[model samples]
Target: MNALIVAPIVLPAIVAALSVLARGRRQRVGAALSLAGCVGLLAIALALFAQASGGAVSVYTVGDWPAPFGIVLVLDRLSALMLLLNAGLALVVLVHALLTGVDRKGWHFHPLFQFLLTGLNGAFLTGDLFNLFVFFEVLLIASYGLMLHGQGAGRLKAGLQYVVINLVGSTLFLIGVGTLYGVTGTLNMADMGLRIAALPTGDRGLVQVGALLLTVVFALKAALLPLHLWLPRTYGGTSPVVAALFAIMTKVGVYAIIRTTTLIFGAQVTGPLMLPAAIASVVIGFVGVLAARGLREQAAFGVVGSTGTLLVAVALFEPRALAAGLYYLPHTTLTVALLFLVADLIARRRADHGDAITPGPRFASMGPIAVLYLLAGIALAGMPPLSGFIGKLLILKAALAHQAAPWIWAAILGTTLLAVIALARTGSTLFWKGRAGEMRHGAVSRLDLLPAVALVVLLGALTVGAGSVTGFMDAVAGQMFAPRGYIEAVLGQAAVR
Candidate 1:
């Protein structure tokens, strides 16, 4: 089972090379290969999840190298969950791309897609900070190409800003990694944790600076505010398929913050910093949502708001709140992805207005799409009968005991109300006040709608299985707070804490 940890990284790397080779001969061959790879990746993720569910940390060292000096991939509940989420999201987005012919816009889509998977899987599993930096580059490089996949002035412009921002982030990542290594004499995360805990009082402040630097980098990636201006334009301008896949990309940042704070710095250091930023993010993101001029822009801001909401629970640094945050994380990912797909469908049908929130002619199959829009809006706004509602309810309940409970409750509920009004207004204009003629520039078929509907159904399933899911999350949170098991698995000794 430990050996299987390498498969997620290896499979995608091999498939990406094959996809590049197959790209020239026939696009279908490449698509089919990429699809097979995603399916296989999903299977591997499920297998790993099953292994992780047993609550044992699994570590895979490269070429039999010893720890603190070797390349290692660690899988516990957190990494396994990220692997599964990315796999499932990749498969669904790939299907949508294939169905909508979005992949044909660029010859390298399949290869880049596979490479992005490689990067994501590597980042999630790597046990060393330096290797995490390497994977971050891998994913960002691929994202540059993917962001500009369907080239246009807007995409090209947004893609350039995206590249520059990430490059700066990569630089910060290296600086932090260098600082930490200089302080601790190692890049291995578990080893660093032990060393930091044992470090003399004098070096404590430097270590905190390094940790905060890394947190800023992660926050930038997660689109947390003051650093989130890149998300709306980048996501809004890109193709819906790319936008949908990129939804999971932000979670990578959130996941990094969660993993590093729990493992290396301990949440006490980063928690206070993350809390105020998170609240600000929620406020600014919802403001963006309400002020958006187009549906895709609205969806993009919705991503920001949802990330803020999830991080609110994470910022609490308490086990129960972390569990609630974990529950909300995936729900937001699914909900935001669903909104992107729905937005695309609505936009494509209306030739004149595209995705603008303004009223336009009745498009082909308007009624069904409107219904989907309503469902997606409900999910986004955390309305009842959806996983969003349950996730937020759990978060609010968990925060009730905190001193900041009032502020957290106010931020979440107030932002939710903002989302509701924005989506409601968009729906009213797009559906109810349409012009006379019915436009059918790109009429959506059942197949085109499948991915969005699938997301809604997945959310429904999450709702139905909330009890079991929350139980699992509780256990996952427990594993995170008690880091001894993770440290021992990697370092062969009990954690100092």
Candidate 2:
């Protein structure tokens, strides 16, 4: 179990190193190695998920050091779910990149992708705040390279802004970590939680400030509301394959928020600020969607709005609401990523227009592409018979128990309506309306469409298995709220009362 717990991180790191060694003229070798690594990650994630399903919190201590004194990795239901989702997403996106030949744009793409996976896996599994920050840096550094993989002026500019903003966020993360460590004298999350629970009265204010700073950093990563201005430009500017992979990056922020709120600060300290920011992020997202001039921009905003929607449920801090948010997480991530890839397919077929909302030459495979867009749009707009609808339904139902239920309901429903309108407008312009021009690209092969189709199929599967998934999420949420087991597992029974 210990070896299994650490494999997801180490496997990707090893693959990334091998990929680096296999780069240049041997790019295909790197791609093959990357693919094998992703497959291995998926397998390990499945095993961990299965182990976590029994409600055990698995711990891996570095150098055999114990408790708050050393590096540790912990796997519970929540982390296991994230690991599984990330592994699946990585595999599909890698296949898409390989199939579509985006990987050929740079010799470094495969290695960077693997490194990004390594960081993501580590972030999800780490048991301490400082290590979480370390993993965040690892992923962000790799993302900087990935974001600039194809290297155009637009991508370079966006990458610059991305680096600058994240550096600031990283600074704040450090400050937050330092402040918390100063107050509690520990960086281990479970141990920190116990210490914070018994925090001295005068030190409470400093802790609150530190927690709020950390929340700000996490919220910024999640692209919630005001902090979200960087997202659309950044995502829209990147290649579709990279953009698709980034769909999971924002959730890293959401993951941190969940972990800290549940494990360290508690909802009373974080929920109030997070709720309002989350609501505003939803509004801004759909508004951006409505106002978008290009398909990729619209999809980027959809990610923002989806993040907002998920955070809305999360900020309520109820077990059921968190469960709803958890269920919504993967659904939205996949849907938005689907939109990005589908947009690329459509854009490739349109000469000189390139994902613009305006009418252009009719692309080959119009019928199939339109169908894919329709399905993605429906999922994004929270329409019926898809996981998006089911996720929204669970959230709305869960929100009913909160005092701010009316606001939550209004934000979700109203934004969903706006999203529908925006998607309808864009789809109508891109697919329905036609202009006199030549198609630059040929028919999209089955292989070209396979990644998007797989996402569609996955969404369908989610809708079909909603009951079982929600049940599992319920247990995961229950585990979060009652985290004594987590604390004990990490620091041992003697650490907890």
Candidate 3:
């Protein structure tokens, strides 16, 4: 067992507990503690990422018990990447909150932030379904608090709806778990996969139903179309810092779908279910973005659309397509997260306009923000000379090999066009449209602005380093397509029947 394997989960848990106890004390203390936690997390993630990138799996069995019996934490390339991304995003979002006075909105904000990190890390590292549920609850609980961090009737209302929807998703998750356990007598994901694979034809009926139930729960989390109704309100209403952190939250569902389907259920059964939903999400996302009123709302809608496009890549189930999806995954996550903060920055300056499409005040930092917005818009719309273009190009190339190529191309390219149009309209409205007579300069915090800039820089880094990143994703896609190594790593070599 690698010592660093447990660090990802343990470090955050310890920080969360400390933050909880020191909750309402000195603001600086909380901030210092949270910063330390993120720094530590980033270190751990990099170490594990190096380890996993070598095609090695680090499994830490809890209480010295073996897998299929005791809890386990498994780190592979995909999960390691997710850990690194989450930690980096946490640090950036925390800095933004501190700079913008968002952490001051609630006493437990820092603690909840740490706890949210804990949940996210655990969900990626856990080797069992039940523990995944526990981690989901942990993060969701923290999210409920953070989602309502800033006091506002709008936030409160959105938070309540978010809570209620997740609560229902949780209930369905439990029922699905129960059904799966009754059939397989194990909660360990790898072991359950083995059992599902070896099951007789007649018994697969219930298992299929269970899988569908689980899919619905995950789909809701990923904000697939019909299930995505709550996102615009919840994500748009929250504080920008909170909304930025949440940029990766829906990906939890996407990750679950990718993991469960590819590793547990096999592509045959999962493909049929995921393909249609992915298509629906892309179409709905395009329509929603065009119809949205506020810039934040538009970004939120774009998230769903872009997510749908990524899932479409995944739904194809070919290694090439899946590899393309993996490449797009982090790119989409980072860009969407940055967009939320960008929206906040833009809104802060144009306070009177309130992120609406119409003209507004000439806020401070217009030049830098306009560039950031343009860069982000191009990436989000899959325009050229950026990581987004590369990701979409890869997906298109791979999808051409698929029988459903036409439909895939139509959905992704079509949405890309509509999204670009909507974004262009919004950009013109926000930056180029007629300005007020007297241009007022709003107070811009250097700290608040830095995080958004830093995020955009990272996206640029992705563009410059595309070759290396694409190679890494291709390897990850291969590993995902072949779950034999993962199963053997988790359940012991003998269990890889």
Best by lDDT: 2
Ten consecutive residues with minimal summed lDDT in candidate 1?
Answer: 437-446
lDDT per residue (tens digit) for residues 224-323 in model 2: 9889989999999999899999999999999999998999899878878889889998998999999999989999999999999999989989999999
What would the per-residue lDDT of candidate 3 be over residues 148-249, giving only the tens digit for each residue? 887899999999999999999999999999999999889999999999989999889878878888889988999987899999899989887788899899
- Model 2's lDDT to the true fold? 0.92
Error of 3 at 309 (Å): 0.8
Ranking by lDDT: 2, 1, 3
Instruction: Compute the lDDT of residue 397 as modeled in candidate 3.
Output: 93
Clashing residue pairs in candidate 1 (N, C-alpha, C atoms within 3 angstroms): none
Query: Between candidates 1 and 3, which one is better according to lDDT?
Result: 1
- Residue 150 in candidate 2, Cα distance off native in Å: 0.8
Cα lDDT of all candidates, in order?
0.91, 0.92, 0.86
Sort the candidates on TM-score, descending order: 2, 1, 3
Q: Give a tens-digit lDDT track for model 1, residues 1-497.
A: 37999999999999999998876558899999999999999999999999999999999999989788999999999999999999999999999889888899889999999999999999999999999999999999999999999899999999999999999999999999999999999999999988999999999998998999999999999999889999999999998788989999999999999899988998767887788889989999988999999988999999999999989999999899999999998899998998898888887787778899988888887887898999989998999999999999999999999888999999999998998999999999999998777666464676788888888888898899999999999999999999899988988864443
Clashing residue pairs in all predictions, respectively, total 0, 0, 0
Let me know the TM-score candidate 1 reaches against the reference structure: 0.98
Candidate 1 regions off by >4 Å?
437-443, 494-497
